[model samples]
Target: MTKPLISTERVQSSTGPMVIASVLNSPSERTSAPHRHARGQLLGARRGLLTVAAADHHWVVPATHAVWIPPDCVHGLRSHGPFHGWSVYVAAPACVDLPGQPCIIAISGLLREAVDRAATWGEGPMDQRQERIAQLLLDEIAVLPAEPLGLPLPLDPRLRRISQALADDLADNRSLAEWAQWAGLSGRTLARRFVSETGFSFSQWRQRARLLRALELLAADVPVTTIALQLGYDNVSAFIAMFRRALGVTPGRYFIAAS
Candidate 1:
């Protein structure tokens, strides 16, 4: 499938304008290898889901959210299906006041509209009106609230082994003790190091992994019952409850609102 027209080398040049915006439309799935740009980027999907991975952080960006990638951050992108979105690239100097790390931020209506308007501009220096719109976009990004759609990965090799296993098989219901033994670490060490490394207990991290997976499956139009079963949930109600607790809305309602 064809990828979005974002070039790291082109966007990162110091001589480029302060902000560069582009609209993305893909009829099928697309994937970009891990890469870095000297320019920071704000990427959001308007009609589908995007999975963005940067360093040890992974974010599931729905239509209502955007992922901010700081300048020179190594990252990759994978679209869940057809994708229609926008990307705004900022010069390195202009990113000094923006987010210092990769995160998923809630996209406000004003920011969305501003980006849409900016995406239509032709190449070259911006006019006074365009400059004002660009500033507005930057202002909105600086203050937008971050959403809890990111999963932090652990740094320890043993912990990564366990984490990767869980990600590969969300239905794995191994207890902390079982996982510790499997990884050749003591249960206490596993629990403590999990919190220290990923800022989440083992169980909490697994739940978050499941939540993120559910979102990917949902974007592909998976049935709720099937998703619950696939994620090892005993019933659909339990899965829905967990999703609602994390996102403050049921799965159906969340996607409905996003659409």
Candidate 2:
């Protein structure tokens, strides 16, 4: 959780569908609080991992991916490593073609160049050339494909506690009985309530937690073998198998395709 070199609040100014790009060097472990934007935004990181949490949905943005956030959706971010990124903001009226909800998008070379060219835009008025670039940026973003890599968070307090515990230590591989004991609940009650509240059993929830954590580590470009050991998988192949099961592609192929 190194302090973020750049803050979102530092670049909230956007006029007439502007693509405001910013470079964030390793951000703090957590955002100060949830914040909103007057206009819809597509936040893309040129490097590092960017995680966005809003309502029950949590999105993890790998270096080659971007996130589309609807206007007025209160969200927070947690960034890892030196993050170079862009925030393309569109006036609400201009957001008709944008995604209606939060989404993780794949960024192509063309879109990346468009964003890089527009990152220089500040609060100052855009000239005709800049205006044209903004329009083109929006057009490029509209065609990018979305990746279903989001982890849904549950609201129940008990389920929330489990999520928080896993977030603090991705390496934890404690037994379910031990976890329940720490929570001071009988195993049966814990097991039953887990599914009732989160619609996922404890084991399933743990797998998801590990899956999400793997993404952050992968975004940092950690070696797959190291990531496997760190996430409590027995070996590299095991980790790759799990990742493939969830994402439908091996880790290396996933990034290659995404990039």
Candidate 3:
């Protein structure tokens, strides 16, 4: 069964320290329901993949990346398998300069080491030296570059239906014309609306959706051939090519580099 990594009550309480940090090193799967708290969060895994879902987008975070959740932003999380991660929570009052929207940021060694040091301080108010470290954490967060690891969902009901269907089954190989007909939209309308609403063409969106799922499955140690076939690729080489094009590495090397 999935487990909570930290005390929800403690993290949500308004009376705690300005910054609270926690670490999770678990063999079991972990998940959290969609919920919002009063703190901005920097969440990353060191040995697994995490999928974070907000109301309008999905993010696939590998070990080299972390998701920044602004204070009070509703989100949920699921780990692919055993997870080793750290989370740094900043009180809402301290979040004014943080990113206004949730995003995936590249994790630097300095940020990871600093968070590890802070995780030992417990939930109490920081001492002077700890306060200085906390400031370093905040400074690192402010400057880390955001990555292209998010999938934006469409607001239009018709496009949402299409997106949900694709998410449910990335292997579905229906063409745009067929999907438009099924959704009661013209092909041109579907193409144009997809670009405007999600900033991606229908083909681009579908490819991205498949890539994200591939990452999730790969994290679970699924075989490349199985994942390629499951994701609607006719041949393993095609899938590998696509994966390399998007991530600059093959599936195997990707996880190896992360490790």
Winner by lDDT = 3
Superposed Cα deviation of residue 173, candidate 1 (Å): 12
**Stretches of model 1 off by over 4 angstroms after superposition:** 1-4, 7-9, 153-236, 247-259
Name every residue pair that clashes in candidate 2: 4-27, 4-28
Estimate the TM-score for candidate 3.
Answer: 0.67
- Candidate 2 clashes: the total is 2
Q: Which stretch of 10 consecutive residues in model 1 shows the poorest summed lDDT?
A: 1-10
How many clashes in each candidate?
A: 0, 2, 0
TM-score of each: 0.67, 0.76, 0.67
* Sort by TM-score, top down from the best: 2, 1, 3
Residue pairs in clash, model 3: none
lDDT of 2 by residue, 117-187 (tens): 77666666789998888788778767776676554555656656666676556678888888878877778
Global lDDT scores for all candidate models: 0.82, 0.68, 0.83
User: Which lDDT tens digits does candidate 3 get at residues 165-222?
Assistant: 7766779999999999999999999999999988999999999878877876786688
Backbone-clash count (model 1): 0
Compared with the true structure, the alpha-carbon lDDT of candidate 3 equals 0.83
Pairwise lDDT winner, candidates 1 and 2:
1
C-alpha lDDT of candidate 2 relative to the true structure: 0.68
Candidate 1 per-residue lDDT, tens place, 26-145, comes to 687777888888888999787555767887786555566789999989998777667677889988888888989888887777998898898888877988999899899899999987
